[model samples]
Target chain A: MDIYDILFWVLSAIAVSCALGVILSRNPVNSVMFLILTFFAISGHYILMNAQFLAIVNVIVYAGAIMVLFLFVIMLMNLNADVEPQKGQLVQLAGVISGGVLFLVVLAGIKSARPVTIDKAASDIGLITNLGKVLFTKYVLPFEISSVLFLSAMIGAIVIGKKEDAKPIAPRDEEL
Target chain B: MPVNSTHYLFLSLLLFSIGIMGALMRRNAIIIFMCIELMLNAVNLLLVAFSKIYGDADAQLFVFFIMVVAAAEVAVGLAIIVMMYRKVHSVDINILNRLKH
Candidate 1:
């Protein structure tokens, strides 16, 4: 295998391993860290696919913004090993079995499908310029709708997360 | 040999499977949320790979939209988790069953 193949294997391995770490780690903080590592590896894959814009965005949005949010929640909750509930061994086994079965099915399907050769030349499809053109021209409606979705999410989060107002209980009239 | 779409597809499938396992097995609500994010990222990887293969920007654009939705989801999901923590004093999903009462 050449450098491209080598890199692909390495990045995918990192991603998969880190993903396992995220699930297996007992501490929530560690899980978040592993998730960040997984995101980084995924960003590397995006780079390999020559999707430079997505690579950058993956790092910035996922690792930067979303992970920090996860970390914040974990820290705010002060989660630790003791408080985390343990799942039954049988359930865990079932989860593993199902996941493995799905993976095998997907692998088999991909292996059986006729391989289509795509042009390897550096394509500008992933570039910001081309992406921006399409985003504004073709997908402008969904783009605006997504903004609205974000706005509603922001409002919902704030409304749900705000501390409840503490009202003093009034004394009973009979007691007076 | 040059890397092809199959390789990328395999990698994404692996990641997505891992994510499914995590979501199924993990008890912590936060970790489960992280697993969901992992699944989303796996999907994003597949979309980018397919975009490269198909020589179109549409799939990549979908990736962008997916990222947007993921961010919004995190915001709302984490808020709900936090709210749950305040009431229950834990992030364990098992404890949430009591909420039915």
Candidate 2:
């Protein structure tokens, strides 16, 4: 096996195991930490595929920002393994079985599909310069729209998070 | 054998299944949320792999947009979770079943 194959196996193992840790860990904090590790492994895969921009963005946005937010919330709530709730054992078993069935079904369906050989040689399409050109020229509308979505999401979060006022001022009070 | 598209496909599928299993097994709302993130990452990985296979940047851009949406979703979702915690004083989702009644 070549270096690429070795790296792929190693990274995939790390990712899969860490993802399991995310689910199996009793503490929410541990789950978050495992999820961060899983994100890092996924980012490594992105880099392996030469998608430098996505690798960086995944690390920054997912592992750095989003995970920290999860950690902060978990810490704020003081959740531990003891306090964590779990589904019944039968339900957990069923979940595993159902998920496995899905995996097997999809695998069987795709098994006969044509396998396209990946070009292992370096490609420029994943580079930031090319991606930026495409993003701004062809996808500019969606980019701007995403910014608007972000603004609305920000507003929505604020409105949802803020505490309700103890007293409501009536229209008659405004008239007075 | 060299790393092929099929290998990546299998890897992502495994990850996605694990995510589904986690989402089903966990009763903690935050953990479920995290499982959703895991599933999203699995899809992202597959998308990047496809982008590489086809020599296309569009899939990569789609991954970028997915990331954007995920970030916003986390912000709003966590706020709602925090609000729920404030109201119920627990992150256990079973407690929310009272909403139906």
Candidate 3:
């Protein structure tokens, strides 16, 4: 096996185990930590695939931003392992079984598919320069739309989280 | 054997299944939300792999869009969760069963 293969295996193992840790950890904080590790492992995979921009973005956005948001919410709620609710043993078992069955079904379905080998050499398409060109020239509309989406999401969160006042409104003389 | 598209496929599938299991097994709303993130990451990994395989940048760009949407989703979702907690004083989704009544 070459270095890429070894690196791929190492990252894959780390990713899978950390993903399990995310699910199995009792504490929400522990789960968030594990998820961060999992995201890092995935980012490593992105780098290995020569997607430099994606790798950086994955680290900055997923591991850095989104996970911190999760941790903040968990801390805001002050959740602890002792108070964490869990599914019953039977339900947990069923969940595991169903997930395994789905995995097996998909695995079997893809078993016969052709395995296209990736070029181990570097590709320039994933570079920031090329990606920016494509984004601004071809994908500019969607990019702007996403900014709008972000604005709406921000507004929605504020509206939803705002507390309602207890005082009732009095009828106006004009309305009367 | 050298790393190929199939290997990445397997990895992504395994991750996705684990995410599904987590979502199904967890009763905490935040944990469920994290599991959904895990599943989304799995799909992102797969998309990146395919992008490499086809020598295309579109899939990676798609992954970017997915991240954007995920961020927006997390913001709105966590706000809802916090609102729920404020109202019911618990993040346990079982408490939401009262909505059925």
> Sorted by DockQ, highest first, which candidate order results?
3, 2, 1
Q: Please report how far candidate 1 places residue A41 from its true position, in Å.
A: 0.8
What DockQ does each prediction reach against the true complex?
0.80, 0.85, 0.86
lDDT of 1 by residue, A101-150 (tens): 99998898888766656466677778899999999999999999999999
**Candidate 1, residues B23-70: lDDT per residue as tens digits?**
889888998899999999999998988888888899999999999999
Give lDDT tens digits, candidate 2, residues A13-116. 99999999999988788898999999999998998899999999999999999999999998888885457757889999999999999999999987887788
Clashes by residue pair, model 1 = none
Off by over 4 Å in 2: A166-176
Task: Choose 1 or 2, whichever is better by TM-score.
Answer: 2
Where does candidate 2 chain A have its weakest 10-residue lDDT segment?
A165-174
Compute the lDDT of residue B45 as modeled in candidate 3: 97
Among all candidates shown, the one with the greatest lDDT: 3
The better candidate by lDDT, 1 or 3, is: 3
Model 1 residue A80 lDDT? 50
